[model samples]
Each structure stands twice: as C-alpha cells, then as structure tokens.
Target chain A: MSKKPVKGEYIETDTGNKVSRRSQIIGTTNIILGGKTVIQAEVIIRGDLLRTYTSSNPGEKQGNPVAVAIGRYCFFSRGCELRPPGKLYKGQFSHYPLKIADHVFIGPGSIIEAALIGSHVNIGANCVVGKFAIIKDYVRILDGTVVPPNMVIPSFSIVAGRPGRVVGEIAEGEVDGMDLREVYREVRN
Target chain B: MSNKRQSMMPPAPKPPTSLSSSIVIAEHASLTGTKLIMIGSNTVIHPRAKLNSAYAPITIGSTCIISERSQIGILKEPEDEEEAEPVVIENGVVVEVGAIVEARRVGEGSVIEVNARIGKGAVLGKHCKIGPLCEVAEGEVLPDFTVIFGNGMRRIDNSGVEDLKMKMVARQVEVLRKLIPSNIAKFQ
Candidate 1:
C-alpha cells in the first residue's frame, strides 16, 4: 500500500495555487481557476461536461465553453467532486458552468453540482450541494447535509439537515477566518 | 488513473493488486496495495475506481461490482484509537458510482448507492440497502436486510429482489471478464 501523502505535499503554481498531483482533473482547457486555489488529492473536477448548445446571445456566458470556474483562494479537500449541473433548457439538454466566488472552502467527499457559490462560503465534509443550487456569500453548510437542487440559499446563513434548511446566521466577525493565505503558505513539500 | 506496475516508492516494491483469473479491473482503475488488496473470482472494477489498503488489508469477494469513481478502504481517522483491521466485502455486493466505503465488514448482497459513505469500523449486515447520499456513522452496526433511506430513516427489508439482481450481476461479470484482459499476471 502507498503511504499517505504528507500534509505539506503540493505543487505550487506561478499564480500561487497549490494542487496535488493525485487529483483527477479532466479536460483542463474547459476549467478556469483564479489564483491561489488549493485542490487537494483525489478531487475530481469534470471540466469535460461542457454545454452542448450554442447560445443565440453572444453576450451570455452560456456561449463560452467553461464548465467549472473557480475564484481566488478557494480550497477543495480530498475526494470531493465538481461536476457541472445539466438540464433541458429551451428544449435542449446542456450542462451549465459552475461558478464559485472567492474564499470558498469545500470539505472532503462532498459532491458539488451547484450553479453558483458566492464568496467566503464554508462547506463541511460529506455534504452534497445539489444541481443548480445557488449558495450566497458567507454561508456555512454543515457536514452530511444534502442541499436539494435549485435551492436558493441566502447569504451569511448556516444550513443543515436533509434538503437543507437555514439554521443560523454567521456573525460578521467569523468571515475573517475564511482566508486561505496561511494554508497556502504551509502546503508545500 | 492507474499507477504503473512499478510503484514510485521504494518501501512498496510489489505490484498493487492480487486479482483472481476471472476478475476484470479496468485500465484506469487504481489499486494502492500489493499484499494487502485481494479480489475474488469474477469481480468487475470499473474505470477511475480506487482501492486503497495502506493502513489495512482489503478482501473483496466473488461477483462484486465496484462502479466508476467508487472508493474502498479509506484509512481511519487519526483520532481513532483502535488498530485498523482488514475491510471485508462478502460475495455478490454492488457498490455504485462515487460511493466511499471504509467499513469493517460489508455483508453479502449489500447495495450501497451513489455518493453514500460507510464510515470506519461500521459493519453492514447481509442484503442491506444504503440509499443515495446516506451516511453510516463510524462503528455503527447495521442488521441484516436493513434498508437505510429518506433522511436517515431505516427499517428491516423484506424485499426478495436480491436473487434476480445476483443473476444479473453474474451475467455482467461474465461479459466483463471476456472484454477486460485478465491483468492478474502483472499484479501477482
């Protein structure tokens, strides 16, 4: 058996991101990542599941081919998956792009198919953020909670339970703990 | 992606799987143990599936189907005090896509659905059905024919569909065994 890769093991990019070699990222041309993102081992990003349709509006992002777009300082833990949500829109089945904003941390073994995840969100381990779900800024999703598809989560709220219900709000002081710079500094072999 | 027959680390020199002659592991499936991971006859492991036995040995029985991206034999947490034992999966088990299993024992004909997690040291009894996205807590003991679903609701199952499913899985194994080359020579 292979020994566990150490906590300090990672590949440092020119843009300051830390990515593990053991991560399974398919079709890199279709995935966009902002600087300083941390992608841990065993994380699966399905960038190949792109939109099959050509949009009429040139200004719409649906015309572009990006499947998973992540912002700065985001952290994805081991065994998590990022797959674009698909649906039949305007009589055509297409997989939409997954857009995640800054300072978001997704925990281990979570499967994310959300349409939008706003800034400073913290999702705990083993949670399932369903397809087309909209999670607003500063939201915290508890472990093992399954957020149903297309649920619009309000900002700064803590969500738990199956098909997720808002339980509490995050205090203003707690947002500072979402910074990933300290973790970025230590994630090097 | 599957690792090459030669491992990168010097501490683990042997090829990482012990497959029976009829077993079919896809080219992209990854096994991370030489002496600790064993597969029985007529088992089918799909692409992108991972089996890691670093902290413990793993024994998978005959006629098992481990679907794509499903994980087996995850290590126990650091805070866990008990010594890790082998993860044992009995005959005719089906672990569907993307599920993570680190259980101590998975009994015969159990069906673990998509994205479900079986935590460390948990024991699943015969013919149990763990529904999609369900979470079985660490060290929990589930009885035979138990069905877990719908926001953690559970009950003893009396459904008699396992025999038909077993025959179907056997047919699948027969087909896959012919398609995927028996790569046991390189591993053993």
Candidate 2:
C-alpha cells in the first residue's frame, strides 16, 4: 500500500527531510525537523545556515549535512529528504550542488539532486529534481515529475511531469500561499 | 515550336469541406500520420495536431475526442528490436488538448488529461484519470481506476526497474524464435 502521513504529527527530517504522503501537523509532532543537532524546524532563524561541508563525491561526503534557509509560515510534508547543498568535486569530473532558498514548500517523495531552488517554490509529489537544475522563484511543479540535468526553470512557472516538459508560464500577480494546515485539511476529508 | 497555350491561371483552389466523422478511409490511419486507430464510428480529429505511427499504433474505440493542439507520439522502442509491435490505444478514450500518449493501449473510458504524458509501452486501464502533467514511464502497467498523478522512480532504485529496463533489449528476441515455420510444422 502507498504510505501516507497522518494528521497533526511531526516527523523529523534527520539526514533528510520528511518524504511521506499527507502528514498532519495537529498532533504531538510539532516540527518537521532535520538532523541530530539541536536546530529544530519552525524555531531556527530564517536565513542561510552555512553548515554543510561541500564534497564532490558521495563516498567522501559523510553524515549527510543539509543546509536549510527556512522561512516563517511554511508547510513541509513527510518523507522529504533534503540532502546538503552543493557537492564540491575536484579534478576533471562533473560537479553538482543544491541550493534551496527560504519559503520553499516541498511535497512528499520529491528528490532534490544538486539543484538551485529559489524561494516560494512549490514542488509537487514524487518529483525528481536532477543535477544542476535551476528552479526560479514562485514555481509550482505538478505530480509525477522528472527534471533533466542542466535544465533551467524560470520564475512563476507551472511544470507537469512525463519526460518533464514546460507547458505554460504562470501569469504574474498570482500569489497563492501554500498553507500546510489547509493542505492537511484537504487530504483528511 | 508548338505555341501551346500555357495555363496561366492557377488551378482553382478546392473549397475546404466540413469533414464528417463518418468518412470511410481507403487506407488505415497508420499509413497516414494518425497513430490512433478508431474501431467504431463518429470519432473527431483536429487538423492541426500531428499523430505519428512510426513507432506504434494507437487504437481508439468509436466516439472518442482527439482535441486540438494535442501531439500524440505513439512511439515504439528507441532502439528498434525486430520483434516489437506497435502501441495500441483502445476505443472510447478521450485524449485532451496538449496531452501526449506514447503507449500501446489506453483502455476504454480512460482520460489522458491536458499536458499529461503516457510513456512508451505503458498501459492505462479503463476509467483511469492520468492527471495533468503526470508521467507514466515506459512499460509500467496500471490496473483499472489506478489514478496516479505524480512522478516517481518506476521501481525502487537500482534493483527492480533498472534490471527490467536493461532486459528490454531481449524483448525482440522472441521474433527470431517464431521464424522457424518448418520446425513448427514438424511439431504439428
């Protein structure tokens, strides 16, 4: 059966973000947190925390350090795995990095691979953000996703999946706030 | 030098006729650019869209709607194996605008929504809603009423689908096995 998250419970984003389906925020689990350190979600200061040790190799990168610039009033679902930003590789090989800005709403089962993600971005469920991908601000991605490596996603765009094609640009002045409580309510009913 | 009257007047352009849905095709749509093969009557197809059957055949039942601005790429295997047949889209399926279906069969009452993509050799069972922008990967089979709307790795990482996709090259090896007609006759 497909694993879906229950309502009002907080799942920690240790080593990775919560990547489950339809988790709730009303229960004892308050913060969807990451890491063994004391830095808790919804309490950490909203800014770039340069805590990740950049390494080009996955073998060299130990203990999965993820850097988060989480903003106020944002909703994150379960099973979202946010690995550390930027893989700094030396020598004559291709290198990749992931940069997530503030107020980014990531859905369940989404994989962000060394991507440049801007603020106010809403990523749909089960999407794969490939290496070196650039996603601009105010972007909404639909479900069942695959973004190829080295591709650029402009601002205010809505992308649906299937070999990942860009259908149309979202019009300006359409600011939709993605509240976790609202999404949780919708999923429960 | 024969002073033949050169036909200076361009031949009168034929008037555009309102295409009826009931026109009988002398050749199948496979010969033309249409990938969808309609079994029943009263199916409508837009003029602007490109329906290609180079890879597979899309079979559609009667009373289907192939909307405008939809590009159907009924694709076969990327590297052709001699044995693989065309893809099929069964009858009574509605493919919306901007939806692309590359599969062999989309069963009856299945709706491939706008901007949705059904991958090569994928099967959509009856009454399924392939939600907008969803990507159903190659050879992935969905049972009836299986509403999948998001992207995912076809199987759990390197073990399941990675092995299956790699073995896809041998799918055409069955054609060579069928070529020995004399051996079959001896068995009979």
Candidate 3:
C-alpha cells in the first residue's frame, strides 16, 4: 500500500502554495489557490463540482469556471474537505463556488461547504460549515460546531453548538491572533 | 512500523460486477473487500470513497454521489446472524463527505450529510435527510421524507418538494459526469 517517497512531502507552487503530496485534490484546473496557502495531508478539495448552470445575461462576460477559490496565507488542516454546495435553482441543479479570503485557518477534520468565508476566520476541528452559509470577517467557529445550511455568521462573532449559534463576540485585541502566516511557516515536511 | 501497518490492512479490493459504462468512478476511489458490488449509470464515486463488500454485497443505483472518505457497506457480520445482509443504496442518493453508511437499505433520493453515521443495519426510507454529524442507531428504521437533524431531532418533510430534490440529484450527476475523470476500466 506504500509508494516510495520520491521527494519532499509538499510540492510548493510557483505562487508559494504548499500542497501536500498526500492531498486528494481532484479537478485541479477548477481550483484557485492563492499564494502562501498550505494544504495538509489527507485533505480533499472537490474542485470538480463546478457550476453548470449558465447565466442568462448575454452582456455579462463569462468568468473562468472555478469551484473553489482560496486567498493567501490560508491553512487547511489534515482530513478537512472543501466542497462546493449544490442546490436546485430555477429548476436547474447547480453547484455554487466556495470562496475563502486570506489568513483563514481551518482546523482538522472539518467539512466546509460554505459559499463564502471572509478574511481572518478560524474554524475549529470537526466543524461542519453547511451549504450556502456565509461567514464574514474575523469569525471563530468553535470545535465540533455544526453550522446549519444557509446560516449567515456576521463578523467578529464566535459561533458554537450543533445548530451553531453566535455565543459571543471577539474583542479587538484578540483578532490579531487569527493571522495564519506563522502557522503556514511552521508546517514543514 | 509502516510495514506492520500495511500488513494489518485488508487485501486489495476485488472488482465489482455490473458497473455501468456511464458511471464516473475516480481512479483513486477504493473499492475494497471480496463480495459482489454493483453500481449503476451516472453514479459519481469520488476519490477515496470506499465500497467495502468483505462482509456482504453492495448495490448502488443510478445517479448516486458517494463523496470522498465515505464508506459504504458493513464493517463486520452480526454475531447472531448466519449471513450478513447486503447494502442496497437506491437511486439518486447522495452520501456526502466522510459519512459512514452501513445501512441495510437506503431509499431513493436520500441525503446522508457530511460525517453522518448510519449504523449497521439501519434502514432509511425515501427522501430522508440525515444531518451532518448525526448518528442513526443500528437497526433503526426511518420513514419516508424523514429529516433527522440537530441532536437527533426528527421531522417529516411533506413539503411537496421531493420531485425537485430528485431532479437536483440527477442534474448534479449530469454535471459530475462531465467534470470527474472516470477510471471505470480500472474498477472493472
């Protein structure tokens, strides 16, 4: 079951994105990983679930088909899954793109199906951010939290529980700790 | 240590019978064990999705989406039973990421959400939705349109939207067929 290790554990991209060799990332053409992102081992990013429904607006320029878009300095821990959420819209079943901004730290074993995750967010281990959920900037989702589908979590909030509820707010002093630059640097082969 | 771990692992998966020509089974998907496994057309089996039929056979119908890390089939035979029951996943079922399904039968259009566990011998009816991280006890039977959510809360969804949901599953499968590169030949 074991293959010979040809090189280092991670393949660092030209843009400085460090992707683990053991990561199961499908449909690489449809995934956009901004520079300085670290994808740990056993992570499954489903970039194959691209949007199929075409927009009716003729004048609007067609954007590149992307299933998942991640910004810089993001850390996706081991065993986490990033899936684009799908639903029936106007009689067409289509998957929407999942977007994540910079400095986002997603803990291990979390399954994220959220539509948008803003900057400086920290999601704890075993959390499930449901489909179409919008998480704004500076949010901290506690461990084992199950954020329900379509739930919107505003900025500076701490969310927890099964059907995750906003339990508290993050203070201004605590927000600085959410930066993932240090975390990214420490993840060595 | 690595050699010892590899020795403990199960034998290489035997190829399943009756895999349709149009099914999209990824090259990395693990089809394991030593029993008959049948998959219908347009079903998308993502990478790392496991179909373990060592204890019993597994039958998956058309347009089903078995996501990554999800395990289908029973882990072991029951102590009291002489033979293990086969797992039957009906048409249009979506077993999401990391879910472990050991169900006796999962009816059509059911959605087993991420990390959900359907215990051994559980029977899920048509259009049933098991929420993320939820657990269905072994041998439990759920009725049609049952929505099992937060902390084991139960509700019947007679919302008249079952047709739309099924259509969505079909469309998702259609899109997946074009996106996921299938290695059906390897599995066959």
Candidate 4:
C-alpha cells in the first residue's frame, strides 16, 4: 500500500490561479460559472491533467475551462472537481476546459472534470464523471458510481457503479434510479 | 535515599488524538488516544469529522482538505482474521465531501470521492482519482495519475500494469508519487 501526498508541497504551472488547500475557483479546461454559482470547499476544477486541449482563445480561452458554463442558481457542494475540455492529443500534453451547461447541481465530493455536461444535471454525491464523457440534460448520477471516459450518457438517465451502467432513465425532476451494484460490474482488468 | 527516587517517574500517557493541538480536528468531532492523527501545516478538518482508530491512526498531509460529514475510521478484523492496520492519507491528497477511506495508505494528490470506501491495506497512487462512492477491495495498488472513475479499475505491484483478477478503470498520463505504506502491523 502506498501513502497519500502532501497538499502544499507541489507547485502549479504559471498559468492558472493558485488552488489553496480548500477553496473554490474557476479555471480553464473551459469554465463558465453562472453569475450566481456558489461553490464550497473541497471543490476542484479538473483542468487538463494531460493538457490535451488547445487553450488558445487569445485570452477568451477557446479550450475548455474546468467548468464550461454554469447556469444561474447553481450550488456546488464540497469536494467537487470539474474537468474542462482542452486540445486533444495522441500523446503530447495539451489543455482543455470542462463544459458545464446551465443549472446543474453538483453534490459534494463529485468529480466532473474534462467532460461535457448538459443543462439541469444533478450529479449525486461522490459520483465520478470521466473526461470527455457527455451527459445530456436532466441526468442524475448516483453516489459512488463511476462514469467511464469518453462515454455518452443520454439525457434523463441515471447511472451508478464501478463502471457505471445506465440503470434507468430518470423522469423529469426525478432522483433515485437503479441499484449501484446491479448496474456496475466490479472493476476488473 | 528515598528522596532521590522522586526523580524517577513513568512516562506520561499520550494525549488523546483529538486533544493534540498539532493536529486540527474539525468541529463536532471526537478523538481519543486510540486514534493517531498526523497532519501537515494548514490542513483543514471540517465540521462533523470523526476519525476512530483502535487499530491505527489517521495521518493527513499539508494543505489537504477533508470535507464535511466524513467518517474516517479503522476497519475491524473479520472473524478469525488478524487485526488490520491503520489508514494513512499522504500529503496533497483530497478526501472529498462525505468520503470514507479506511485503508493503510492513500497516495499524494489522489482524490477519494464522496462516500468512497477503500478497504484494508489498499494503496492508491499519486494524482489518482478513486471515484465517488466506489469500493476498492484490499491488497489493491493504483499507479500514478490513474483515473479509477467509471468502472475503470486496475491493480498494481512491482511490475507495471499487468492484468489481474481486478479490472482497471484507466491509467492517466501523470505518474503517482512513490511511497510505501507505513508499517503499523506490529502495533497490534
């Protein structure tokens, strides 16, 4: 078993703003925070760890922000991580931002970096949305479920698991879909 | 001759883990000597945090964020099973809101998502992501920068990404920090 890393010890690149131990901020990988977005601590922007997208919007930031575009009246709980779109690369490191549509609810400890999330999405607590995964509007990701990279979740669906399979389609304003264990298979190589 | 004996005294009992000012315990939490907590500078423990370790202590690195409503505890040994070891979360790691990590070691810069449960002696690599509400079984090792979200699961060891009985979610581009789990097996 390996140990966890220290927070203050690492250094960030010259580009983005500093991420304090526990604070909220907006950054590229494509972040569009709604005018009234209220985010709490343990929140993170999943910028391109690989620098995959082109962030050359000439200050406008063409690449994805960690959050693409948050709508008004959005509340992000603690421990949320957002991944934006960036330049895609075969191997070379590029950068992109996350694209979040309007009116999304990101629960605590949720990770949505480098993905395309549509409007009115309610991501449950501790749900992990992979890079480049497209989630349409009204999608509810259950707690502790995993969304694979580059996968597309049709709108109004509920997903849960190690590799989260779509348990069922969520009705309008509906929560609670399928059993996490039944939908997702245990992660095996 | 009896007066000289006054100089001899037994060592003091350790302060309860919650009382150690060296470590920051969040509000609405209780800690005791049964738990050991080692945290780096500027690490914040949110309200309603609870760490109970009869088997081992909870260690966190500097500038890390342990979110609210989180329960970090040691797992009891199963019937006929030897006592398990302590849970160690290294520097720069983020234990997201409502996440539960009960393991030997979680690597630096790794993110354990909300409501995630890590089993005994599981080692996660640096910059890795253990997605929300996921459960990683014991004796699993994750390499650096690997993303374990969305059913992406793999195991690690001395040799690189060889296929195991376990399924790997995905290994990212970055390298995780190299660290060995602190040996707490003898404490029991």
**Better candidate number, 1 or 4, judged by DockQ:** 4
Q: List per-prediction Cα lDDT, in the order shown.
A: 0.83, 0.49, 0.91, 0.56
Quality of candidate 1 docking, DockQ: 0.07
Taking the tens digit of each residue's C-alpha lDDT, what string does model 3 give over A1-189? 459665788989999999998888877899999999999999989888899888898998887899999999999999999999988788777899999999999999999999999999999999999999999999999999999999999999999999999999999999889988888888877
Q: What is the lDDT of residue B46 in candidate 3?
A: 87
DockQ of each: 0.07, 0.03, 0.75, 0.11
Highest DockQ against the true fold, candidate:
3
lDDT at position B104, candidate 4: 78
Q: Compared to the true structure, candidate 2 yields what TM-score? A: 0.34
- For candidate 4, the docking band is incorrect
- The fnat of each candidate, in order, is 0.05, 0.05, 0.95, 0.23
lDDT of 2 by residue, B11-50 (tens): 4332222223442221112223333332345444532234
Clashing residue pairs for model 3: none
Query: In model 3, where do residues sit more than 4 Å from their true spots?
Result: A1-6, B1-13
lDDT of 3 at B56: 88
For each candidate, give the TM-score of chain B: 0.85, 0.58, 0.92, 0.65
TM-score of 4: 0.46
How well does candidate 3 score on lDDT at residue A165?
98
